[model samples]
Every structure is written in C-alpha cells, then in structure tokens.
Target: FNDGRIQQLAPPEDLYERPENGFVAQFIGENNTLEGTVETIGEGNCTVRLGDGSVIDALPVNVSRAGERTLLSIRPERAEFNLDRLPEGTHTVKAEVLEFIYMGDIFRVRLRIAGNENFVIKCRNAVGQRRLRPGEVIDVGWLPQDCRALEAA
Candidate 1:
C-alpha cells in the first residue's frame, strides 16, 4: 500500500516518520482525522484553518480552493497522552476507553469520541499496555502541524 512515486520519494519508514502530504501520512496509519480550510500556503508548508478556527501548518497539498474546506488527518500515536494535560488546538475531543486488545506486537486501543465516533490507536506492546479501563475518561490531543489538509469529499 506504500509503493508509488510519492511513496518511493518517501519510503514507508520515512513516510510515517515525516509524511510528504496529508493523504500519504494518514493512509499510512494516522488517526484523529478532521476537515479544514487552507488559510495560506508557503514554500514547503501551508496553513490550514480548521473549522473551529485553529490554524495548522502542514506540508503543501492540493486544497480544493483558497477558502474551500479540507480534511485534516492526524495519527493518534503522534498525539500526546495525558489525563490531566490537554494540548492547545481547535480539534480536541474527550474519548472513553472502550477496549484494549493485544494483537501480537501491537496493542489496539479502541476509543469512542463524543459518544458518536469510534477511533482506534495502535501502540507498541513494549509500552506494557495501558491500565485505563473501559469507560475511563482520557484526554486526546493533536498538534496543528501534526494535522493535514485534505481534499474535500
């Protein structure tokens, strides 16, 4: 799934480590995806103004229009986890731990955000697994740069 001109330029490892575009990054395994608008563009980066008015700086991509809405995708692993601390941004959601399953080398954490959307976050088993129980409230965060502006659907 990670082989193409774009994928070749950024090998699978490098693509996930540092994606060249929002689509490439999310397709690799990013969570916390949202939609936004292109506020401005730079030489190597562009500012995506989210629906909530938060601006995210990300690699340049083809936005629909100057003011058209776009999708913002983020990987949960890239998010900072803290029960008491919350990151500053426009897209912040409180999710409840629905289940944590051990799938060999990775731990699959299933969460329900806003009681409507379900999100899955993959973490290495070396983390020793999370102690949070089902229904436990947890804080999820995503940085602006960590998010990307995608074409509108």
Candidate 2:
C-alpha cells in the first residue's frame, strides 16, 4: 500500500510476476528501473526511447500509447549477458561492467546501462559461466515479456 491506500492485492507469485504499477513493482523485490519514453506501441509490447537515445522493446504493463513516459522494470536475474541464451528478436543494450561480486551461489554484477550506473545483473555460479571484469563492455538482453513498462514514478 502507498500512502495508506491499497495499491494491489494478490498472491505472492502474482505480486512479483505482475505488479499493477510502479509502486508495487519496486516494493516487491530488487528491480532495475529505466526511465524512458514510449516510442511506439505494438501488440503486447512497445518500444521505449531511453535517455541515451536507444530504443528497446518492452511489455506495456501500465503504459498506454506512444509519447508516454514509462519506467521499465526488469529483474536482475532475468537479464542475460549471453546472446545465445536469449530468445530470438530480443533487443540488446550495451552495458559496462562496473563491479563483480562473487556470492556463494550467485555472482552479483553491477553494470552501467542507458546512463543508469546502478543497474545490476545476477548470474548463477555454475559451470560454463563467464566471469565479468570491471571496465568490460558487454551486451545485455532480455525478453520483452520479462521487461514491464510501468507508469513513470
């Protein structure tokens, strides 16, 4: 609830999978929020023009038409650095690796993308996983459905 008003009420899975607005999206878990403007709207998806003038496809969750400001929400774990692992038609953005922390079971990778220096991506500690280094540039991609375009906060 925001400011003593109910924002959304649903099961735990539903709350995380589908947030109603920016508030719910942020309150639920760790999310990478990118501020952008809607460039074009399509069936079940839309293209967002980021501050860097790059366009990315995203699922319109709370955004309506073109020209509307939106905050694209993506989970760090949902983002993939390996293009081969990502599905076809996924739009990729350049990300600079700022820091890499090796956790017990997961590696926390901090990246800078679209002018957001705090953006992060989590990679599981497994075989065949590539180790990221600071100052390294890489392409990050995620499925459009995994990125939710919510109302600007």
Residues 1-99 of candidate 2: C-alpha lDDT, one tens digit per residue = 889999999998878888878898888888898999999998898999999887899999888999999999998989999899987878999999999
Model 2 stretches with alpha carbons more than 4 Å out: none
User: TM-score of model 1 relative to the true fold?
Assistant: 0.56
- What is the C-alpha local distance difference test score of candidate 2? 0.92
Candidate topping TM-score: 2
Clashes of 1: 4
Lowest lDDT block of 10, candidate 1? 82-91
Q: State which candidate has the highest lDDT.
A: 2
- Clashing pairs for model 2 are none
TM-scores, one per candidate: 0.56, 0.97
The C-alpha lDDT values of all candidates are: 0.61, 0.92
